[model samples]
Target: MSDAAWPAPPQGSCTLPASVEAEVAILGAGIHGAALARELTLRGVTCALVDKGEVGGGTSQWSSQLLHGGIRYMLTGDIRQMREGLAERATWARIAPRRCRWEAFWMPHRYWAEGLAHRVGIGLYDHWGAERPGWPAGLSLGHVPKEAFLADPRGVLGPFRGATAYADLMTWDRELTRDLAASSEAMLLDFHEPEGFEQGDGGLKLLHLRDRRDGSARQLRARRWVFALGPWTDGAMAQWFGETRKRLRLSSGIHLWFDAVPGCERPWAIRRPKGRILFVVPRDGLLQVGTTEREVEDGWVPILEAEREELFGALEANLPSLPWREMLVWAEELGVRPLVAATGATTHLSREAVLERHARIPNLTLVLGGKLTTARALMDRLATDLTGLRCEASTTAPLRLWDGQAAEIR
Candidate 1:
């Protein structure tokens, strides 16, 4: 499936024209940009969506691919974030059913006290999501049988108290992102890198771009401009705003994939040392074990040999029965995410998306730190706040992507 080809563009349209004009010009084509394009187009605005590479080919594709309600956020008492994610999760299940599906997730508890606490916590999560459509009821198993878990032959090291199973939506992250971009009525320009831009007379923004494949120059003009450059936010900001204090703290996360365990069909939530959360997700007949989170100075950090071993060691400590080293596949992915710069751990930083008008550039907005599950909601808020367009209440439900015949953001 990894080798599958992306859908070709419409017939007779292979390259971007030399010059284009629109009401709005988007500088990135990740999920955020795609969603914003869709939202803006729905509000009767014309947009030009451009990307340095293929849509969703950046950090958007490297997600864990779970449209979960962020159960880990409950630890920090962030019920608002969890509720917002849960609502968005339900929205995805309702609108993009072909691209997303509900999957059962299990979090095993070793000690009785921990098991009880998880039950209470997950119950709260269920309560918060209960009002949303397609929300699943939580199931607390007091004594999950060994057969119910994908335990190692050596047996789990800790005393088995039970497991809690909950529902979360899973998606083909890259495919969904591409579909959103394709569905947007805006002009889609893949492989077009923004070189630089200058403000023209009368508040028009002139953006200089180059076709990455042929190195052909192009000019795009628009009344409004948006920077949804994700991990590249720092670099683009530095180039445009000229060396302001760092606004983003970058973090690198890496995931490794392995052939599925014989009977393991559901995803597992394993608690690592130091209270970090790791997930073993099963998708497309492969089990993906990940992810190691570490703060980095920039977004170009590579996955080291020691990081792989660290992931395996954590898996062995938690689920020692599985063949941690032997079932490894040849593919691994690494992605960098930007968080608000602060003095605490990266995990503690708010995962909420940041949308702010550029201080130096007129009619320019900068977007940072959004997740796949909450992208639509974030963009809806952006549309309302930036464009003064009120989203019709009916458009919130039964959303459709580009794959459907009648695609609309509302």
Candidate 2:
């Protein structure tokens, strides 16, 4: 889609005021900050959300775009996280059903042991779905014979014993982030960079900001603040807050796009040779094949040519019949996963958001490491911790994020 055709997000004045004041000041406009702004605004708290770039123009723009329940977490014995994700998934379905929908995921296995594991995992997932009250039931897992699987995609898939199909969600992650920020009453200041922080009188916090558009200095004073910088957490903390103890384990992920191949519209979650998972998702007339993971030193989102070849190899390994190289590459998306630092590999780091309250600074919360699927709950916790606002389940859970065609009305 052309930039002119895209819905313009709710933005405050381009000319930065000499000084601005708000109840809360958020330092990032990615999914985490956007969700936090929405949560605070919904509770009648005024907010100023400042970002160095456009809203959802960072990692949020380049997600795998699946609002799944984290069924894969079940394999790691993180049942609580899985259930939390599933509950949040159900809530997203309730509020913005038009933006997201359940889609079938085909898991093809070459061996009986692998196929049995998939079946058991999916069966447990279904049973767990039943535990969430008021949520829709999960679709039953269907065992597809090898012949039927090959026939449906016109024998495009490589050889496999059989496959199991189940359901999760597919969404427009970038649009969802934009919609949340737009739907809120927070002052959205894109292209504004936070230079540094200072303690003002009366326990107020001062943010030194430079308006990126004009290179003009601006001041924002707020009683509370949140640093939801995602992958930029480490660098931002060091430069702006001066407390960088390595808070994030950065994992770079890349996705390749191609023309929508006929009969391959169904999404696939195939296990790669090293136990990593790759998704084949069809969205907006393009097929997105992604996501390879490796630990990185910085937050630079790069689509390395080596990684491109790796994904191309993965796609070829799974769907050898598709003429991927001959076809034009529709697009390529890349992002860094901001996972909480841990002792293990980057892939094993926690996807949960960590709320770091500054010991020296009062009423400031730093958010690190979160996923798009669980942003709402993370911000809800942050809201409660920062404001003592009672999170009313009746009001928050069912709040409509967007109402069909009127989604951009705000």
Candidate 1 per-residue lDDT, tens place, 156-265, comes to 55444457766677888887787677657888877776787776554437888877666678999888888888877887677755756777888788898888776676
Q: Which residues of candidate 2, in runs, are more than 4 Å off?
A: 1-16, 130-140, 145-147, 154-157, 200-204, 393-410
State the lDDT of candidate 2 residue by residue for 230-285, as single tens digits. Answer: 88888876776566599888888888888888777568888775447888877778
lDDT of each: 0.75, 0.76
* Sequence-dependent TM-score of model 1: 0.89
**Given candidate 2, what's the lDDT at residue 310?**
89
Per-residue lDDT value at 276 in model 1: 69
Runs of candidate 1 with Cα error greater than 4 angstroms are 1-14, 131-147, 150-160, 200-204, 393-410
Error of 1 at 61 (Å): 0.2
